[model samples]
Target chain A: MTDVASKEQKLSAEENISSKILTIYLIWSVIISVSIIIVGTILFIVTGKSGYNMENLNSLITAKGSLSTYPFYIQSIWSGVLTLKPFAIIQLGVLILLLTPFGRMLLQVFIFLYEKDTTFAIIALVVFAILLFSLYMVNILEALHIA
Target chain B: MIYIVIGYLMEILVASIAAGIIGALGGLGGGVLIVPFLTLYFHVPISLAIGASIVSVIATSSGSAAAYVRDKISNIRIGTFLVLFTTTGAILGAFIEHITPVKVLFFIFGIVLIISVIPMLKKIGEEVPNVERNDPLAEKLGLYGEYYDSVLKREVKYKVTGVKPGAAMMFMAGTISGLLGIGSGAFKVLAMDLAMRLPIKVSTTTSNFMIGVTAAASAGIYFFTGDVNPFIAAPVAIGVLLGAIIGTKILVRIRSSSVRKIFAVIILIVGLEMILRGAGVI
Candidate 1:
């Protein structure tokens, strides 16, 4: 099913670290996505229909505030898991993942450059530039709240 | 319960497809297309709609990014640096929602969206095929690049600079995404074309490409908070996913220059609706 010929044609004779690393990253991403879906499903079943509404969510957030400043052990070992609000945790995760493309893109560039393939590097760069600019726009709009 | 789950699943399927197509071709988040419908027709809460849209954005990004990287359409180095700032901004913006009033936020969101589309409309008529120089600015900053357009069947090369304005514009795009859950597609295009002076095709492709990652980052938070009610978001996501796919296929054949006007008009109407709603005039 995989494009073996195309893959072989792209990869040079050298043992390129960038391509190897990227392959690892892609594998990890798939694993993480699947695991999260599974875990989330289990949590949904365990939680049942109890207190999933907005009111409970607000309470969860408030509880987080109270528990956040506890000592390292309490905050990390107990409160972080037990009172750890989903919104706060999920928001941090999603946003961090959102920035993954930038890193992924950088990895692509390093691979292309290592292969001495200027053409692919150029294309990768163009796409990266657009991402950068789009990011810049997001920053400005948020700061100004001009909507 | 079973019916609700089935219905929700169906909605997400549709939304995912629509977001994927629009994200691939039109270079915008599928969420922008989904949220308004959810809030207006489905009577879903705005917060929940935003959350679902965020998830779809991440999905779209993942789908497209993998393909684009394989096709050599995305640039990693530049994309990486930009994310450093956008992610920070997204984290901060998500928290800001806690402080801002819902109505006021939407009003501002509607206004900014309208303003963002105007410049795109203005540039639609001019199709200049020229690359700026790879001078000290482009070389030192490492912004020179190229892409192959399947439609045009040609390689397009480009040079770009103006990092300051581009970064500044990204800040605005991040804010809009956090506020409206739309991923601010047009604003992203504007920053690349206007500030960095990249080709329109390149700008659209990259913007279309990176939005998913940005959306995913925020989606995680919404999911943990239980803001993502699959029921409401499912229908909206499905409808938009279908709509966007249809829109993208048609967009290629139709004159997008003129469509920009239509899009602008739609946003204007929506803006007025939002204003009326905000003012209790509805």
Candidate 2:
């Protein structure tokens, strides 16, 4: 009981710093991404055109439409960004939304290692490895589709 | 043409807010509601619906977790420790998503959800769990913490046990997240609150924190599949984020026991719907 209390006190002191950093970072990213999404949605509503095509809105809402096989490649997303396309901009927000957790996990693994918590550090490493592997799996799946 | 788009976007935005609130409260990741709403009502392609739901789940988890983690209520130790299982499970589930029929997947997920609720129903209104057993792994990993309960006006400390089983359950939770493009908060909460013997609030907020990481892995694959359409993702993300923020606010003020009951009921309803839908009745 006393040992538990001592441990709690120790964590609240140092763990406090990392927790604060995570909170601020998460908040800012969500704000940035949500802002971008709002702007992109507004731009599309007003202009009726994004770099891809205004017609995409048709299939977008259509039931069981053509979106299944259409994979929005990162390369195209980059090109779309260069052109300031609204849909691309929104996808950028989506990308950020997707990346936030990746960032958090990476940050956590670093923190665990820095604190010399080997067990958690190793666990976090495994999680990080799995995260990276999932991305690669996507490419493999896409390739298999082409083949 | 513009009006139609406006209507669709507006409707989704409103529905997503409700989904976001429920998801944040229950740690569900919001996909459970979003996918069905998009498909059954809007006639969205299953792939597209899955894509959008995965993205929205990310939004809800991150949005709600911001406060929970900052407040130190989310148990970062346990969250980080458990993420390994979920991430691995999610990868497998995402791969299976490509091969399996979604209805069959939802049915299994539904059964899991319903089963999880039974344990929770017995302990509804429990503010803090009284755990007697100790797991050496949990102790070595320091899987215990303290948080302030604003509603109770007291500091609550909790110890963790059942490390192996809880981790096993988290893997299933992660697979459900990947399979359904949801946070699978129900399963996560059950794993912690039941298997791991955590306080309901701790279980919920920690689940909220972990769901994002779990969903993010599979969401990556969904991205390239073009399941994540910007048109669908945009409003869902925006509304769910807004709603999740609201949920976190409500969470701190309510009694933990009530939170458990709410989680139980929500699980019950969503589970039944999924089963019915999976059976092609809906």
Native contacts recovered by candidate 2, as a share? 0.73
TM-score of chain B of each: 0.82, 0.94
In the order shown, the candidates' DockQ scores are 0.09, 0.58
Angstrom error of the Cα, residue B167, model 1: value is 1.4
Instruction: State the lDDT of candidate 2 residue by residue for B207-270, as single tens digits.
Output: 8889999998999988866677888888889888888889878877777777667767877787
| Candidate 1, DockQ score (0 to 1) | 0.09
Looking at every candidate separately, what fraction of the true A–B Cα contacts under 8 Å does it contain? 0.02, 0.73
Docking tier of model 1: it is: incorrect
> Lowest summed-lDDT stretch of 10 residues in model 2 chain A?
A62-71
The lowest-lDDT stretch of 10 consecutive residues in candidate 1 chain B is B230-239
lDDT of 1 by residue, B1-282 (tens): 534544544554564565445544556766655665455544455676676676656545554444455445455545544544454455455556545786776676667656876777677755434655654545764666666655556776777777677777877776677657766676777777788777665665567554654554444444434455433433343344445545555544544355455565555565566556556565
Candidate maximizing DockQ: 2
